[model samples]
Target: MNYTLNQLRIFLKVVQNQSVTKASEELHLTQPAVSIQLKNFQDQFEIPLTEVVGRKIYVTDFGKEIAEAAEQILQQVSTIDYKTLAYKGQLFGKIKISVVSTGKYVMPYFLADFLKMHPGVELEMDVTNKNKVVKSLQNNEVDFALVSILPEKMKVEKIDLMQNKLFLVGNMEEDFTKKKKIEAILENRPLLFRESGSGTRQTMERFIVQQDLKINKRMELTSNEAVKQAILAGLGYSIMPLIGIRREIQNKDLQIIPLKGLPIKTNWSLIWVKGKNHNPAALAYLDYLKKEKEAIIHSKFSWYEMM
Candidate 1:
């Protein structure tokens, strides 16, 4: 009950790093000082927050819950500061965004421009799989998420930012230059699939089912880079977003497999939970996205045709 914000911050740091020593280093506090505050924080709570085993600290289930709460509190405090600055006509605050792995290709340009225009704004970006990004958005852990596949369960306010072209790609050495029918490709070639729960994989599966096509799953990879590498090594062909493989295609390392109904069109969307009150920074960035999306896409990715 007597824990201060500083104490909670130290606790959060410890939870994040899983080491008091590391937390102390990052916090610029002596190890003993960090231990004392951690003890004070734990003493205020009836339940144990963390346990030490083999010289490593691990957060308990209750600790995890508390960490989430602490993060919310910290974010709220940060928002208060942001709001105060906004009242004075200053654009400043931290914006946390999570994007699917493929979005990494394009999202950075937007962030870079935003940061340049609003020099006071701080940005934190998490690049992860679509499932984790969705979870972060659902939990209110991020201000916005960039993704192609929207979750059916969550009530989200989204805008179509751009088109994501999904293409069947293979190694340049493969004889995919010749146009082939979807049915023949699926029947003859081994198909590389993204790991389950990926937005890319989900879209590809839906397309396969809609077209009544069957595939032989040759291998499953977790990341786009991994899947691309597998394809480059002649492991198998995969359906991937054009954003992630543009350079490879340009370099002649990979080639698109022309098939009927290929290049599935999906929208890249900027989304946040419906009814969530966005901070000024988030609102400003959203406005920027709305106003500059076309220019942003064209300026950064002019080489690729916008579908």
Candidate 2:
């Protein structure tokens, strides 16, 4: 009860990151200072907030509840700060965004421009799989989420940012002199796939089912980078987003396999929970995205035409 907002902020960060070291680095405070503040915060309650196991910090059930309360308090504070700045005809606050792994290719470009225009704003981005990204959104842990597929069960508002195409890709050195049907291709070459619960994997599965195709799954990789590497090493072919593999395709390390019903087109979207009150910074960024997203996408990813 006697703790300060700074202490709550530190506790929130520690809980979110599950590491005092990482929280200290993010808060720009000395490790000892962070430890002291956390200890102070914990002392206010009789129940232990967290426990250490194998060098990792794990929050208790009580800690999780406290962390959620702290998050709401921090968000309210940030909203108040943003509103004050807006009233003064200035913009300042933090923007927290979560993105699926494939979106990492283009989200940074958009963020760079936004940061340049509003130098007072701080940004935090979490890049992870679609499942985790959606979980973050469901928990209101981030201001926005960038993804190719929208969740069916969540009531949300979204805008299309750009075109996202999933193409069949393989090593250029692989001999495919003879054109083959989808069935033959699947049977002849092992298919590299993203791990379960990935947006890309879900899309690929739907496509396979719709086409009445069966896959010879060679391996399941956790990240797009890993799948790309596997394909580059001639391990197998994979259906990957064009945005993630533009560099490899340009360098001739990989080539798009042109087949019937190829290049499944989907839109990259910016989404936020419906009816949630967003801070001024989030609202401003949403407006900026609506007005400039097309131009930004065109200028940054014009290479999509080459694919």
- The residue pairs that clash in candidate 1, if any, are none
User: Which digits, one per residue and each the tens of the lDDT, describe model 2 over residues 1-307?
Assistant: 7999999999999999999999999889999999999999999999999999999899999999999999999889877877787788888977999999999997998888988998768899999999999999999999999999998899999988888899888998765666667667767568888999899998888888887886655679999999999888888888889888877878989988877787898888889999989887788898898888878877887778556
lDDT for model 1, please. Answer: 0.87
Leading candidate by lDDT: 2
Give all candidates' CA lDDT scores: 0.87, 0.88
| Runs off by more than 4 Å, candidate 2 | 1-88
Candidate 1 lDDT over residue span 219-241, tens digit each: 78888999989888888788889
Task: Give model 2's TM-score versus the native structure.
Answer: 0.75
| TM-score of each model, in listed order | 0.75, 0.75
| lDDT for predicted candidate 2 compared with the true structure | 0.88
- Model 2 pairs in collision: none
Candidate 1 steric clashes: 0
